[model samples]
Target chain A: MNEQLAFTIEVFLNGLMAGVLYALVALGFVLIYKASGIFNYAQGVMALFAAMTLVGIQNGQVPFAHLINAIFGTDVHKFGWHVHSFAAILLTVIVMIALAWMVQQFVFKHLVGQEPIILFMATIGLAYFLEGVADLMWGSELKALNVCASEGNCLPQGMNVWLEGTTYEALGYGFFIDNLDIVASIVAAVLVAGLVIFAQYTKQGRAMRAVADDHQAALSVGVSLNFIWVLVWSLAGFVALVAGIMWGAKSGVQFSLSLIALKALPVLMLGGFTSIPGAIIGGLIIGVGEKLFEFLIGAPFLGGATENWFAYMLALVFLVFRPQGLFGEKIIERV
Target chain B: MLDDAKQADAQVDNVLEVNNIEVIYNHVILVLKGVSLNVPKGGITALLGGNGAGKTTTLKAISGLLASERGEVTKGSIKYRGQDIQHADPAETVKQGVVQVMEGRHCFEHLTIEENLMTGAYTRTDGNAAIAADLELVYNYFPRLKERRKSQAGYTSGGEQQMCAVGRALMSKPETILLDEPSMGLAPQLVEQIFDIVKSINEQEGVTFLLAEQNTNVALRFAHYGYILESGRVVMDGPAKDLRENQDVKEFYLGMSDEGRKSFRDVRSYRRRKRWLS
Candidate 1:
């Protein structure tokens, strides 16, 4: 009924929307970490690369054009053609699959049976190498990813006018909500449901979980570790692409987009790295906690911008109480 | 050196032939030094040894699981039905019908009992009906597993986990199972129950078994043939009946001498004077 209440409700709704996006990214991390125990520092970069690749393919830009032009003294960038967004997305997925295969074959295959810390260090190296390769392939420039069909069907931007007018008429105050955020929430829900079904029912999905539980045991049962790892990486890549398209559309495809992973770290800490539902719930908690804190106390008492650090602070406090995370398997002790 | 009576039993077609295999761990530590054995088809062959005597290492070598632990069969060969499988991967070995149930019951702890059994059928290309039939067969063998099928394996007791491991392996329809220390950490009664299941599985399913165990008395009882290993080498090999009657095995392994039940103090000194080792 009041302006403050309406604004608070608006913030809460926006926080849920943001949490969905965080969960999208967190899904990628959980998939890879669950299967192989690799933290996959490259996940965020994989998103950036997928988004950039999608844009490049849609624009018909030649891969490594700059390097080729510099070497051969030929000026050729694009083929002067555009690809349909749907076709470009399909091509990007294929490319992501190939990248998954190459990563497993060239990098991780030899690193099998190595320590977790060693595998983690390898992923760190892979992240930097992949980031550099993506920049070289697509050129480091801001690009707009257009997934919409046309002007009428385009991803609607700006505040929802209908919501604002309706809320104003009902409560004597307007609520702000972005149409893009609503779309993101729906997409994230569908993605999560699909993942849960696949994991719960399918043969390969069961194998993935088996591998996650015990690699040696899974192998003994005839589960191919290499195939499972590649499958997991490809799934992670697909999730990353979905996340990439969402974030890239929100703010043009840029280097800073990868920093979204830094935000997801606190989410993982809160959710536990081994859980999917924990990720979603943790993301929601972090998102709402930060937004509410910024609104109530951050602006009025503390200097504004507590939103930047609030999630981490909350996650740190949460870790003190529940280190295994909300949904993590409890470590059982036997005397 | 085979005796006349036991030599005739060795004529059965060997399902698995592990010949003079030397396993090296981390490329330096020699674990299995030219260990050799033969597992007759449809019989339970036991590898009996003490701690660190390379029983588990030999099983891992045959099952192609040693590579995962940074242990490699660096010398000799392992043949399953005349096919060389020393370098085959673990998955390939499983496909070839050789599955190793690792020691300490390495069940997928997070998975439910049924889900863990299903994972054993991962490599099978047959339809779900076949897998379901096998699931029922496994449950019949391990009804306790069926009762706790929905419970997570981590919460299961030690004996139950051991049974779950064997049942899970059985779901793979394996020809030969390399069971490593199934008796470890189980009560004596539970160990007897597990050995009974292994005997029944061997008789009913016609599956070959190369079980590595430290309980020489029980292992000798269930096994048709037995090999004794000391410091990674096969010290003695014979039919289980003859092995049970061997004077050296009785004194050293079964912990009984012709004189009487030897005390641990005298046995410790007598172990150093092993005639077989000399």
Candidate 2:
């Protein structure tokens, strides 16, 4: 292949890889939305919270060290020991589960039967609350998450080292790709498969889907609504944590980690709020579409920020023809 | 007939009982006005009423779905198998062997017919083998459901949805089912077919039922006993035969009188006419 065409293919592959990350976050949204009718805008912040908590626990940093030092002029900062990565991850999972339980107890439990738009807005409030708590707990500093499957900070790197030696030498061009992206993509695929199996086969999964279909019917059939809601929220939290770890390691754990949640909004609009497969497929489409657009048009012509609005514009146009989304059930109106 | 006559003389052993229940909706709107009724063990009893006559509200009260809608029985009591269940959650009520097949046939539209049926047995810890047996039993009653077992409930017609709803309720193995408007919005033939299935389920499975309906014609035909509600009060009640023969019920409810297709063989019609005359 020619140089330009090879470059284009590389960009396209990178776009698809980015799409996998979007799908990770979108899965969190889909899980919570499907089970509880909660369009959780807090999902991104939940990820941020998880990532911050994971790093703080790993590094043996005192919770609220900065706030304590500022308030009391204390010299205390570190706990003087480090937690193993596996231990920190387990602890983070516990924290996420506890957070899920608390969120249900405090925020969502009282808001049952509220409108979807209202729930969505409530989640936005929850996002702010979670962000504040995360900042208070972890001092809100940029932290490098270090729990990679292989090497170089949370994921394997230097995948292009091999490509440059053999495949690229034959073609007079090397395909540059991050092993982290490839690893993240595999983790996402595994996460989605696990979720699908849980939803399709397990009793609890069926109960969750039943709750989604008809709350009253599910209740009458003897599935406790509150229990199912908690289970769903915790599952979403775990998903958010996975997303957090991946994104945090990529960009350094910071406030911007939560903005990736915004990138997922167009994915939801395209995929439909209640669909799992839709979230994945929608994420992929948005991921690839934005990348290709930026490469072919934005960088060369309309400026480099077309990636900011391309997904949204595409979702808007698609929804005009199919309002329920690509895989969402077509809504049937009854008088 | 003899047993029903004995039931008319006194309460013939009820599996579920509602006594003078007053319900309020949204803390202000009073919906059920001291309503009372009984379901004879292993028999079908129909509660007949017009729209807004509190039939659905009464079922919601018994099933514990009212609270989710902000409706609560603020007065009186409901007993299932001699246990007070007025404040029980809907899931609790289901576990206690009383399930309500809700009005409007709220089948899980996204679920296949079989999955919807399986959900009805969600609370049961009984072996899968028995649950499977009960599922086949449900399919036998509503064979159309078995034919469309894999089809999504949303795409099915109204009659099939109703059948699926009832079949789902049966998966719980409930002793008493509070059926709300099973005959609503269906062809006359389908209505009769549904009632026939209900009757057989009552007879063969030995399941008791308290069905609230507006169709007095079909309800009275299949029900062993009938209670007529008007504006949330139990205005009239008797064994099905006596209720069918009553003058006021014949005219106002069934829309039949002496001149209609209904026979006036009973000489008591004159005395009943005098009661209306005064």
Candidate 3:
């Protein structure tokens, strides 16, 4: 490819990678929303919390150490012992599970049977509460995630090197691609496939679908509603953690890390809130579409940073024409 | 083992007994005022009433699904195999071989016909072979379901949806099935087809049934015994033959009375008259 074409292709590929990250977060929203009918605005913060906890545990940083020092005027910071990446990830998983349990027990248990709007508002409150809690537990600072290290840094150079050597050499120009994006693409593919299998083949997965279909019917058929809700939230938590690791490693762990979750909202609206594959395909569309728009029109006409609003516009237009979304179940209204 | 032995003792003669149960919805609205009924083993009993007669509530109460609707059996005992199950979870009720096909044919519309049937066997810990065999059994009774097994339940017709509901319940291999309004909103021919299937299931499978319906004529044809409820109270109940012939039932429920109807409506202080008692 020529220089301009190579750049465009690079932008498209990068956009696709960004879309995968969005889909990862969107999957959590779909899982919780489908099972519990709670549009969890806290899903993004769950990712932030997971990444923060992973960093804290990995570096032997005491939770609320900063707060403790501020309150008592002490100089204590670290616990003086470092935990490995694998151990940190495991510990983070446990923390996320515990968080899921506590959320169900404290926040949602009392709000059962409430309208979807009320639950949606509750999740917004939960988002703020979780963000605050995460900040207090681990100091509100940008923490770099050192996991998934390829060579010295996680930005995979191999794909770029390979493209430069072979494919790009043929075109007299190389398309730049981040190895992190390549890794994320692989992780995303596996995660989605694993989720599909887990849903299709597992008993718990079947129960989740049943709960999603009709709560009262599922209850009558010997499916425990509360248990299924907890299971779904925990599964969403695990998805959030994987997303946290990938995003945190890509862009350092911070409150802004949670902002990536906002990217998923349009993806969800585009894909339909309840469909899993919609989340995936919707993610890819938003990713590639935004990049292409920015390169072709956004930068020249609107100056830049068009990726922010382009997705929401696309979703809005799509919804106006097709309210059911690309793959969402057709809603039948009975008067 | 002990619980199983106790339940086995309760399981004889009558598969289910709802005794003097008073159900209250939202902690205030009285729905079932001291309603009592028995579902004999391997016998089909129909609870007949118009809308707001608490038939669905009674079914929900027996199936332990009252909690979902903020309804509770404030004063009553629902026994399954002679054990008090009023306070048990809905899931626990199903686990003990009692399944309810809910009103409005609440099939998992998103699921295929076959998947919906498989969901009925969700509570069973039985071997896959037996579950597969039961799937075939359900298919035999409702061959329409077998042909449309891969089709989504939502897209199916109302009669098929009702059949899917019953078929799903049969997949559980329950000792007793609570079917609410099996004839609602279906063509008369389809309603008769469903009733025939219910009767066949009762005779062939020996499954006890407590079906609630407003169509007195069709329900009476298949049901061995019938109860007539008005305003949450069972005013009269008897063998289907006797109830079918009674003048009051014939006039009020079945909408057929040879006697002139004008004088009966014009009677003074008629609320005091117990025509059946007289």
Docking outcome class, model 3: acceptable
Q: Order candidates by lDDT, high to low.
A: 1, 2, 3
Clashing pairs in 3: A156-A179, B10-B81
**Candidate 1 lDDT by residue in tens digits, B1-278:** 45443445544678899999999999999999898898887888989989999998998898888888889989999999999999999889898899999999999988899999999888788889999999999999889999999998988999989999999898888999999999999999999999999999988999889989999999999998899998888989988888999998988888787798877887777676673455
Residues A103-186 of candidate 3 have per-residue lDDT tens digits of 888988777777889999999999999999999999898988887473223345664444223223336766667677787889
Q: Model 1's CAPRI class?
A: medium
- Could you tell me the lDDT of residue A161 within candidate 3? 46
On TM-score, the stronger of 1 and 2 is: 1
lDDT per residue (tens digit) for residues A1-335 in model 2: 79899899888888988998899899999998887878899999999999999999998999988789999999888999888777889999999999989998988877777788988898999999999999998887688887654233322477434322322333777887766687789989999999999988888888888898889888877889888988999999999999998888778899999999999999988998888999999999999999999999999999799999999999899889877788785665433
Model 3 regions more than 4 Å off? A64-77, A150-170, A332-335, B1-12, B260-278
Stretch of 10 with least lDDT, candidate 2 chain A = A161-170
TM-score of each: 0.95, 0.91, 0.90
lDDT, residue B273, candidate 3: 68
Backbone clashes in candidate 3 total: 2
TM-score of 3: 0.90
Candidate 3 residue lDDT tens string, B1-278:
65344334434577788899999988899999888887778888899977898899999999999887888999979998899999998889998988999988988878888888898989889889999999999999999999999888888989999999999899888989999999889999999999999999999998989999999999988887788876678888987777899887877777675855635454423423663343
